[model samples]
Target: MDDPVLRFNLRELPVPMVYATHRIIRDCNEEFSELFGYSRSDLVDRSFARLYPKHADFVRTGHMWGAHLPGGKTYYDERIMTASDGHRFWCRVHGRTRHPTDPFAQAIYCFQALTRPVVLGKIRLTDRQRQIATLVAQGKTSAQIAEEIAISVRTVESHRARLMKAARLTNAAELVAWFSTQNSS
Candidate 1:
């Protein structure tokens, strides 16, 4: 990676790549700028939160990184991301940290847009609810979701009930279907 040609190849590899520290973009390749419909000048030295669909999403996702990055795991997730013009797409994101013990101190991430139907878009979910909904959509059981989010199983059920009520659904199966359905314009 220290070789100039190697560096040049990676930067122009046609994958959206970014380098960030403390969740702020330190630099990004040309493909990344294009992917987000932003000039390199516009994105550099800015918080990555601007690219997320909601402030809640930004905050909630950071929690995931905090749990994994310190262990030097290659974090991965498929989530909806937003472009500068407000266009949203599902993308599989992969990230790694150079500073494992202080992951947010330095990290690199890449994005690959997915072809799946958009998720979590039709619902107006709060941060915690959205986190639970994501897990639910991933087919996680109530017990698993509770353990991951450090809440009680009963609390998880409460959220599921609330989500069902909000979506006018009757049960977990319907709740999952409601949350996963594609946008109908």
Candidate 2:
């Protein structure tokens, strides 16, 4: 039998999968295109940045996840992704690098769109707001978020306040409920 991990028919895979070179998509399965509402041709030779909701998300995810690839780790995260029609939704992204020594040199990724979206329509959050929102949704306290991301607790609280105001929420508990449909589930 063929080695399942080392060989498979990309086109026939049920999962949305992409083959990328240094984070630039070079090929993708049919499910990948369908999930993102793009043609395979549209993604080929394109930077993965285009599918991200924000440049900061792309940069943050890349640096955060790519850090593990060099150590032969398969990194996965649940985050937001954008479709071609400008619709954004939650997705579980999983990736692994074949060339572990030079991680981004080549890698494969699979994306699974969550059944229920956490972001319901065009609620645009600024880069910092998005970061703060993610941390908040993940159940991180203001102090914990500040320490993790190297920002002042006051700054974190301020962002949370703004988010609450924008959402017309009364408190942090409500704010969390307003943001996460259960972070990822």
Superposition error at 34 for model 2 (Å): 0.5
Local distance difference test scores for all models:
0.80, 0.80
lDDT of 2 at 130: 68
Over the stretch 10-91, how does candidate 1's per-residue lDDT look in tens digits?
Answer: 4766789998999999989998999889999999999989988888778778888777788566877666778999888777
TM-scores for candidates 1 onward, in order? 0.79, 0.71
Q: What is the lDDT of residue 38 in candidate 1?
A: 96
Worst 10 residues of 2 by lDDT: 176-185
